[model samples]
Target: MVQVDVFWSYALGASFASAASRQLKIKSNPFQNDYFTYTLLYLSCIFAPSGIYLLWQFPHWETMQVATCHGDLPAWLVTIFSITNITQGILGFWVSYQCIKAGRYYLAHLQWFLAYFCMFFVLVHGWDGLGWQRFLYDPTVLNNQLWEPGQHMGLTFLWSNVAFTLYVMGIFVIPFMIIPMSKWIIEGAQNSPEVRSTDIPESIQEIGITFLKLVLGCSLGGAIITSIVIYIIRLITGNLLISFIFGMSICLVSGYYFFFQEGKICYDLFKKLFLAEPATSQKEKS
Candidate 1:
């Protein structure tokens, strides 16, 4: 049963990633100049259902404990975790791919790298649990030792920590990336010399609002959801401080970026929207 769950989860993750990648390559450009927006929409549609399902089907307390105990988690719990991780990776990749197609390669690559890194971590950790019963039930059992010290020092532990760190950092950094891009994209659209006098400013303002919503939705929403999950996991595992730090770091970083950088973006967006129309109208009248 455990093996079946693991296989299914891997299949789902791979299938979702492949589908999302293909969807991102479809171009409805000029009419829709924002590849990021389209990709984000697509990802939200595809993965949001899985996320919601996970949230709803969250394991009961006893099950959570059984899974977290030093041995191989139950098949059901492994399936849930696998699905969650895979969905996260897919969303991150979709966001990155959109950015790259839109020429925002730095943000795109950052998101993509994070996505793959997270995927690697999920696979390693999930698979590590296959022989977990032996390690947890009998630590002194020599032949059953799943991980060598060198592997731990070199690959397993080191990479797991690295992946976790990156995951936390990526969540923190998302708001910062979105806010500036929002401002730039809106301002560029508004200030374009080719836009008509009446349409430019309104269109820009609408885009700005849309971007603001996207920032808030992804940053705050993700932070809140992640916090709840971490808290639950901590409760089950007795790793309170680690979970607190991880959750709080996300909130603090996202809050700082939104309050400072995003505030600036909002101000600039408003200024551009207000000025653009008048400037275009003046030229037309002259």
Candidate 2:
């Protein structure tokens, strides 16, 4: 818990600095802007809730005892976890809002729907994992033997299954949507007459490029770190499914956005280098 708190603090500080820098126009590279935005988005999704919850309700020591004993966290911790879950939904809404402001209605709608979906899952799952009633109610009876007593039964498990299923689906689907959408936006901007016409200072552009590279490096590095952790957990427990599900759930929604989104932006820049035609005119042709 202490480590998690420290991680959140560092991420929050970095996000706050990046946002401030961008608003001040200190970084002119579109890549820097893209990197900062996605970094904030990921932090908001994963850490904002935890931070907010901690601030609101500090867990008592006794509560920690119960959690350690049962392998289930106390209500306060669950509340904090919920804060984290709900904040992700808020981040999704913010993303949709940004897309709309940028005149990307399709992307905006997509993001909005996804945000709502996330919120719904958080609500139904009770944030602490108790909302899976179906599994509790109808136990899967096999050979008149109970593999594990007091385990989830029928419809209770069904709902839990649904939640997991949605999470799994998001692992692959969200990246496909976000990666292309970010690419289109960044590449589209490069060809804009206004962006091309603006006399951006070389120093600013250099700073932006540097920042972009840093963001890209950080994102990829984070993914690698997350993968290593997952590998270690699997090796220790010999249960890959739970680890994979949890890890992928966190990664796809958080780090993957930064990686693929930045990749799209970079790809756009390369496209502009090779294709002489302006992106706006190309859009018209399409």
Best candidate, lDDT? 2
- For every candidate structure, what is the RMSD over all alpha carbons to the true structure, in angstroms? 14.4, 14.6
Please provide, for model 2 over 77-175, each residue's C-alpha lDDT reduced to its tens digit, 9 standing for 90 to 100: 656654544344344434544543444433443343233333323222322333222123321133222223233455544454333543564565345
List model 1 lDDT by residue over 73-126, tens digit each.
Answer: 456655565455444444454454455345443333234323332333233222
How far off is residue 113 in model 2, in Å? 23
Please, what is the whole-model Cα lDDT of each candidate in the order they appear? 0.38, 0.39
Query: After superposing candidate 2, which stretches have Cα over 4 Å from the reference?
Result: 1-71, 88-167, 171-180, 183-191, 194-286
Cα TM-score per model: 0.26, 0.25
How many residue pairs clash (N, CA or C atoms closer than 3 angstroms) in each of the candidate models, in the order given?
0, 13
Candidate 1 wrong stretches, greater than 4 Å: 1-72, 115-286
In candidate 2 the C-alpha lDDT for residue 230 amounts to: 56
Q: Which ten-residue region of model 1 has the weakest summed lDDT?
A: 132-141
